[model samples]
Structure formats: C-alpha cells, structure tokens
Target: MFDGFTPEHLALLRGAGVPAAWPRGGVLMRQGEPADRAVLIETGVVKIVSESANGYVSLLALRGVHDLIGEFGCLDDTVRSASVVAMRPVHGFVIAAPRFCALMEENGPLALAILRSVINRLRHADDQRAALGSSTAVVRVAQVLLELSERHGTPAPRWAPKARHLKLTQQELASAAGTSRESVVRTLRELHQRELVETARGAIVVLDPEGLEWWEPEGD
Candidate 1:
C-alpha cells in the first residue's frame, strides 16, 4: 500500500496522523471497540486476533512496518472486528477515522491501493483456511515460519552467521498456524534436530532456509 503512494500522497497520509508508540504486549486496538482511528505502523510488529464466544482466540494476521491497521473498520463504519496487539515495541501514527476516510475520498490512487490491499488480505484469508483444512501440522508450521522469514526477517548477527531471525513467540506461531503450542514445540524440535532452525526465548533463527523449504516429516 505504501509502495503505491506517490511521495506527496505519502506525506499527506503521514501528516494526517499523530505520532504514537506502544511497548511490547500493548493493545493498540480491541475487538468490538468503536472504530475511531487507523494506525500506520512505522516500526515493529503487531498481531491481529479475534476471540470467539467460547474464549478461543484466533490469530488472524501479523502487521509490521508500513502496514495500516483498523482501516477495514474505518472503511465500513463498523466496530473493530479484531484486536491489534504489539508483538514488540512499536512506533507509529494514528489517523482519526474521519481524516483517513476523507483522504481516501480525495485521493483516487491511494483509495485504489487500499482496496487492492483489502482484496489481497481477503485472498490470503481464503488460502489460509484452505491450508488449515487440507495441510498437515508440519506443513502449516513450515509455511508460517517461511512467511515470517520472508515478510519480517532480519539477518542474524555476526555470532550467527548465515542465519535469519524471526521475532515471534511459539504461542503466536501456533496461533497463526492453527495448531496447538505442543505441536509447534514438537515440530520445532524436529527442525532444530535437523539444523534447519534455532529457537530462543522469543525468536526463531533460520539456519537453513533452503533446507526448511524442502523439509518434510521423517515418515512422510
């Protein structure tokens, strides 16, 4: 979405918002809350989740730098459908709903970009649902890791040469993969044993991305 904006348009969007920051574990927005504003994430990651009536929380997606959240609510004039929690310390800007909607109305290209982004998200949701129904736990976990690496990974430090780090927790990964935490633990243990990844307290380092791509369960 940001890539589609012209410099002037980007400046306008940024200028409309006030600067804000959130510590790790902060709730930027909550489900069922009034849709009053949209957040433009300038740094760090956040998780979007929805809680069911039975108290089950489902991870819907992850948003990082340059991502705009809460726009769906703003667009539809409805309450927030999910919660946005900071996965790490986050810095961003908050644009009030009216301003955001006005900007969209006045800017054709920007509106189109946001529309495309929404369509892409819907498509991704559909694909995720299909995978959850058809793919094995191993496949789902691997896919989630690969997505994190591709979308948000940073190269590992000098001490971990040729590796890449993903800043996400095991529980979060399990939620995204639609599996149990124990299952993710077992799968990650297998991955570690195969030297495909290294896990720490709140991060996973990919030691062999290519290998992970080709990895399958031993008996598969």
Candidate 2:
C-alpha cells in the first residue's frame, strides 16, 4: 500500500500517471493479459479473481484505497496473474510499467515501501491458504468477514450505532471463502438467526463484529 508515501513521493507518482475511472463491475485487468500498466487505487474497492481451465472463478483478495494492482507483472515482466474487477465505482491513477519501474529506481524510499508491501502480501496469502485448508467452513467465513472489515469497512460515527455495512454479494463471499454458495447461505442463516448479521439485497450488515469474529460451530 502507498499509505506511508510522503508528499514528494505521491507527487512523483501522480506526475508520471494518468487518472482513470471504472464503474462498478467493470474489469480493470484481465488474467493472463499483458500487464503494461499498474493502477494505484485512490477510491473504492476491487476484487482479485482467477479462473481455472474449467472456467471456474475464484476470488483471491479485496483491495481498497492506496493498494497497487498489477504490480507483480511489472516486477517480474510477466502477464497479469489475476483479473481485477471494480466492486464499486473506482477512481485511480494508471502508471505505465516502464514509468513505474523508473520511479522505483529514482526513489529509494518508495522502492523499499513497495518491497515491504509485496512481502506482506505473500505472507498473508500463505496464512490464508493454511486457514482454508485447516479451518471449518464457518471459521473460514468468519475470517473472511474479519479481513473485509479490516481492509474496507468504514467505521460508524461515535454517536451512531455500532454496525458495519459490507457491500458484497453472497456469491462473492462464497468465492472469497473458498466454499460453495450453499455453504455460505447456511452460515449466513445461522449468523442472521443469532442476530450477529443482517443480509439485504446485495450487502451484509454486521451488528456484532466481536461475536462474528469469535463464532465457532456448536459442539466445538
């Protein structure tokens, strides 16, 4: 992420890039395509997705403001590893691969920050893979919710009730959790019955974040 960037560093990047926008559901980058540029998200969220030979799609991660997309390709000179789609209307800066590489070479601090971010993401991916393999479906769901909240949630005002609204469809949640839609539906029903979450047309409202985070299957 570029949250740690100083004003000068930000200015350098902005000067080298062009601003772009995408409506919700628009594809920003396609898997296996030439990664000629990288996007630095300034607003809204995007989902990283990958498709298999069988045409099954899997959601890898949710990225929000300040996150860099398609940088892996630029770093390694490879095609895009996954597709990125806008989860909401998005505004960002698009920097050509060559320009981005040049910026890193010209700025030591910016390069170091990018390296740290890459390492952190690799570590987080490893942890998530392990969790998916070892944890129950409910636990995985809870973990995903916690991650979404930490990454994209907007905290309610101090005077307002403590609730967080996440704009994600059940199918998207299922893909992120690495489970089936039926499994996600069952888990949501349980959470709804417990008054921990409320589901609307295409969103989820967390009424008790603590309870959701600590939830475990009965008899566990």
Candidate 3:
C-alpha cells in the first residue's frame, strides 16, 4: 500500500500506464550492481537488506505497493548500495531509472509524494538505529514487536496479535537485537511466567505490551 498515495496519484499511474506485474526473488538486485531499473510494487512484499563484510545481514526496509526501491542509486548515478529480495511472491511495475526520472519530472505531484515517502523512510531508519544501539534488549525486542504488530498484526480490533508474522528465527532475532538466544529465551520465559507472553509451537505472542518494554534488567 502507498504511504502517501492519493486518488489523483492512482489516476496518474493509470495514465502513465505502468506495467501491472513484475516478480523476482533470490538475487532481485545485488550490491555494486548497476542501477539499471527501479521498481514499484503492485502486490506482495519485498525486503531491502544489506550484507556486511563479516556476512552479517541487516534488514533495511519492507516495501509494499507505491514504495520505490533502488531509485536513490539510480538518481545518484551509482551502483546499487544494497540487495533486494522477495519475502514472498511479488508483483511490481518496473521502469528503467532514466525513464522513471523523466516521468517524475513530468509528473510533479506524484513525484513529490514519492520523494516524501523515501525521505520519511530514511528518517525512520535513522531513528531505529539510534533506538536499537542505545536501548536494552527488552526495549529493542519491544520495538520489533510493535513494528511486526503494525505490518502483520491482526485486524480484529484486538489489542495485539496472538502470534506475529515475523519470518525470522531466534538466531536471527539475537543477531538483530545484539543478544544471545539463551538470553532471549530467558527473557521470554520470564515474561511467560508472569503471563505477559504466550508461546505457541514456534511463535511467541505479546500479552502485556508495557511489561515487555519494562523488562530491562541491570547492566543489560
């Protein structure tokens, strides 16, 4: 979905006649690869992630329809700075970078909205970095839960989901949160004993949101 798509913008997309479907996984785009094209989603989700020299991966963004990826590299005349992978099957409308720039130049209103969306995402990433680096693991996990809740949370007017749709394993969670599985498991157990979380077969659910955030221990 568009973070800032308007009815007028939808009209513009239709008028421009962008394609209705584009899909790829695995190596959707590679680091240092030329920015040959930019894509806008029409369906499904894609992840923008970067691999470090040590082979650690950091998730950058999750994009749905109307969220543009690789546009920055294309605009800056540089190679792609990161890789994009399809989390699931994706359908997108793709255009060469030069053409997208030309279209944006001609279509001022839609261009402005897209630019704003990109800027907002960068700002959010910066804030997330700050929070994760300075906060405790409990705080970090709490934030992740809130994020998953927003994107994959149920829509039944419930306080939160009984289970999250995070497609990450415990090791992955530990890496992202800068902690260990034992510690994470311990924290989960502590929360569980207090009836603040419920464990399913492979997933965990947050019961008392504030309690999870309040779980910071000494020297943690």
Candidate 4:
C-alpha cells in the first residue's frame, strides 16, 4: 500500500515507527485485542484469520510486503477484527495508533493512499464473500490457489522459470477455501493427476497455473 509513497515519505514513516521481526507462525495481532498500533510489512507474508467461539478458524486474506495490517482497528478505535499471523519470517515497523493518525493528518498523500488501500481491501472481501456463497468447493479451492499464487508465491529464478510455489499447508488451504480439509485434499488430488500442481509436506508448486485457471469443476 505504501508503493505510491516517495522515498522521503517512507523514511518519515520508518522514523516514526519501531522496527520489529517475527518468525513464521508468530501472531502479529490477535482478534479482540486493543488496537494499539498498526504494522507496515517490509518483507514476507502474513495471513489474516478469524476464529469463532466453536474453535473454527477461517483464513480471511494473505498480505505480503508493502502492505499495512491493523489499520482498520486503529482507524475506527475498535478491537482488532481478525488475527494476523506470520506465514514466513517477517520484518516490519510498528507505528502507534496516535502517531499513525498524526502522520496521516500531516501528510495528505499518505492519507489518500491509505484510503485507497482500504477500499481495495473492502472490495476484495466482498468478492470473497460472494464466491464463498455461490461457488463449489472445487472452484473455491482453485480460486484460492490462483489468488495465493498471484499474491504471495515466489517466482522461480532459473529452473522451471514460469512456475511458482506456495508455502501453505493443506489446513491453511482448507481455511482459505472455506471447506473441509478432505475436500481440499480431494480437489488437490485431481489437480495433481492433471499435472497442474504438486503438493508436498507443507507446500504446493504450481507447474501449470494456466491449466488451473482453465480447470472446470464437476457439473460446471
């Protein structure tokens, strides 16, 4: 979201925030916690998850470098709506709520950029909700795979130049697709048989992303 910011603007933000590092699986922000600060991700990926009283958890979004987390709670002065967990080793800066508000007020361009980012997030949420309501489990899983590849997958440097790998567990994929782990496993098996994706212990490599995109669910 800070992609539009100038070097001076980024420097100003970094100066006003405290640098922090998180190992994979660390919880950056917890649901229901007070919104004390917002994190600006400098590197790595994080997953936003929402948990219910019944102990069910859902993956709401995957955020990567240059994204800002916890801004919604800070902007509204409410408790965090979802939990943010590090999907990989993460490096970022934490800006206190008051300082963040002050910085936005002092910088019109920064405020505008943040507003646009928030709008985009809302639209994405709407799209996800619609897909969850209407799409089949196979379609949902495929959609999540495509989204993850586009958002967080790392590109191959030399070998298999056009392929990308997603560092996600089957459980995480199930959560993101809003389906049972068995269902995701079944869908993945079908994809695997087609030579579209290869799944290992805790990761999936997209060998034929275009094939995944063109795949049709049963009865579709």
Candidate 5:
C-alpha cells in the first residue's frame, strides 16, 4: 500500500488480500501468462527464472521480503517476460492489473517512487560491473565480499551492492565472473584459509571483508 490510497481504491482492495501461497519449487507463474499486474511478497522468497534451450531452470534472480514480482508486467500488458518460482514458502499481495493502473493514475508520487527505485538499482548494478571489471580473482572475490558486506554487513543499499534479487549458484558465479567452477573453488579455498569468508547454510558469509580486499595474492 502507498502512504495514502484514495478511498475508492481502499474500498476496492478491502477483500482483495491476494492470499497467495507457494511451496519450494512451486511455479508462481510461467513465462507466457498474460502480463497484467505485479505481485508483492508478504513473506518468503521468490525466484525469477530463465530457462536454457534444453529447458533447465536457471536462476536469474531471487527476491525476498517485500520484493515485487513482475512489476514490469503490471506497467504494460504483454506476454510474461520471465518465469517466477517460489524459492521457499511464500505469500504475496497480488495487485490486479486494472487496480494497479488506477494507482498510477491517482498517485503521482507513486510513479516517482518507481523511478527512484529503478535509479537506485541501476547504481548498484554499475557497482557490480566495476567489481567484475577488476583485473584479478582476488579483486573479483573482494568485490563480491563488498557486496555481501553491504547485504549481510551493513545491510544497506548505499553501503552495499543491491542484488537481493540474485540467486547465484556456483555455475552462475562462473558465468558472471567468466571463470570455471574449479577456479571459483580454488579461490574460495584460499579465502577460507585466510578466514576471510565462510560457507554456511548454502551461502557464503563474508568474515573480514577488509582483510579479504586488502590481501592481494602474489600474482593478482
């Protein structure tokens, strides 16, 4: 909900508690559904997926805690541009297409909110771009650590890269950093030795982001 919704809009959504749910691996939506409105996460996680030519599920993004699913679809009706699947048990608020349109029409400020959000995200992507452009694996890893420091460290977008939507597997990291899994593993092992990062609960936790960034390998 916006800071204020018109009374008419409020009345319309009185009973419209999207009340949606998804289990892990549940398909929230397919790739070709009629694109209308977007979904808001009330709880749990959602994954925006991309598929391979042979039809394997590839994780494109992961959204958690108040993230919007398919907002682009809501703005303009078209074929669904991507697939959304539940990464964990999820519940959301589904803003229907017409209602969403009404919101934009009634609230000029809402439009501004959208634009600001997009700009902020763009800045984060630019940071990640700089991170990848780094000349060495240490730098790349440090950049990722910086990102995580912002995520799990300071937990703020301005202080960290905004990639809450990214669900990076080792394969995805390989694709992002242009390296093999073995290389990633080797680097990770080195980082582990220095206690700069630790693997836990299916994700990497940055221990000493400063130390990780400061310690450059002999060649790198």
Candidate 6:
C-alpha cells in the first residue's frame, strides 16, 4: 500500500498518526475487538491470525514494512475479524479510525491506492487457499519458505555469505503452510538432506533456491 503512495500521500499518512513501537509477541490488534485504529508498519514483521471458536488459530498472512493493518475493520465499521501480532520488535504509527477515515475522504488518490491494495490482498488470499487445498504438506511448506525467503530473507554470513536466511520459528512456518509443526520439521529435515536448506532454533537458511523451487517428491 505504501509502495503505491505518491510522496504527498505518504507524507499525509505519516503526519496523521502517532509513532508507536511494539515488542516481539505484542498483540497489535485483537480478534473481535471494537474498531478503533489502524497501524502503518514502518519496520519489522507481524502475523495476522484468525481463531476458531474451539481455539484453533489459523495463520492468515504476514505483513511487513509499509503495510497498513487493522484498516478493514475501521473501513467497514465492524469488529476486528483477526488478530495482528508482532513477529519481531516493530515500529510504526497508530492512526485513529476517525482520522484515518478523514484522510481517506479527503485524499482520493490515497483511497484508490488502499482499495487496490485490499483487492490485491484478497486475490493473494484466494490463491493461497487454493494452493493449500491442492498441495501436499511438503509442497506447502516449501512454498511458504520460498515466500518468506523472497520477502524477508537477508544474507546469512553465519551460514554462508550467499545463503538466504528466513527469520521465523518452525511453528510460524507451519501455521503459514496450513500444516502441523511436526510436518514442517519433517519437511525441513528432508530439505536439509537435499542440501536445499539449513535450520537453526528460529531461522532457516536457503542453501539452494533453484533446487528448492523445482523440487518435488521423488515418486511424484
């Protein structure tokens, strides 16, 4: 969303909110909470999740720098449908609902940019659901890793200068993959055996992106 913003629009948005920060594991937004404010992330990552009545939490998506979260509930005048939690220490701005709406009403371009962003988000969600329904556990896990690598990965000098490190926990990876942590562990082990990746406590290093991208079960 911020990527599409014009300089004037970005300035307007940044000016509307109060700067804030959240520690790792902080709850930025709670599911079912009353609509109040939206956050514009400037640094770090957050996980969006929806919980079932029986306490089953489904990981919805990950948002990072320049993403706006909690806007949907504020836009539609509804309670929050999901929770946003910080995956790392986060710094951003908190814009109250009324102010946020005012900004949207007064700025046509900003509103249009936000609308396009929402549409893109929905499309991505649809594609992810379709992939989950059709893909094997290993494939799903691999896809999640690839996405994390593409989005948040940085060079891991501790592993190899060229290796890409994905900074996330195994359970987070499983949640994103729509599978069990055990399954993710097994999948990572296999990837390690194939020399495609290396895992530590809370990170994974992509040793071979090309191999991982084209990899499939031997018999498949």
Q: What TM-score against the true fold does each predicted structure earn?
A: 0.91, 0.91, 0.75, 0.91, 0.70, 0.92
* Candidate 2: tens digits of C-alpha lDDT, residues 53-168: 99988888899987888888987889987999998999999999999999899889888887878888888889889978898887788779767866776665431266777788
Ten residues in sequence with the least summed lDDT for candidate 6: 1-10
Q: What is the descending lDDT order? A: 6, 1, 4, 2, 3, 5
Per-candidate total of colliding backbone pairs: 0, 0, 1, 0, 1, 0
| Model 4 misplaced stretches (Cα beyond 4 Å) | 1-9, 156-159
Query: In candidate 5, what are the lDDT values of residues 1-220, reduced to their tens digit?
Result: 2233344433443334366778877887788888876776667766676766787555455566655566577777887867888756788777787777676677676556655555666676687777677657646655664554443232223323432222345554444455666776777788779766655444555566667657776564
lDDT of 2 at 4: 53
**Which stretches of candidate 2 lie above 4 Å from their native place?**
1-8, 155-160
Ranking 5 against 6 by lDDT, winner = 6
Better of 3 and 6 by TM-score: 6
Candidate 3 residue pairs that clash: 22-92
lDDT of 3 by residue, 1-220 (tens): 2367787865565444456453445556788889987776667766677788998776566666666677787778888888888765677666677777787899898788878877887787788888888877766765665575446433332435443444444554555566767766776676667766665544456666566556554455
State the RMSD for candidate 3.
4.1
Off by over 4 Å in 3: 1-3, 11-25, 153-164, 175-183, 190-220
Model 5: residues with Cα > 4 Å off, grouped in runs: 1-17, 54-59, 145-168, 176-178, 213-215
Whole-model lDDT for model 6 versus the true structure? 0.86
Count of backbone collisions in candidate 5: 1
Model 1, 100-155: lDDT tens per residue?
99999998888887888778778778987897779888789988888777677778
Off by over 4 Å in 6: 1-3
Q: Please give the CA lDDT of all the candidate structures.
A: 0.86, 0.83, 0.65, 0.86, 0.61, 0.86
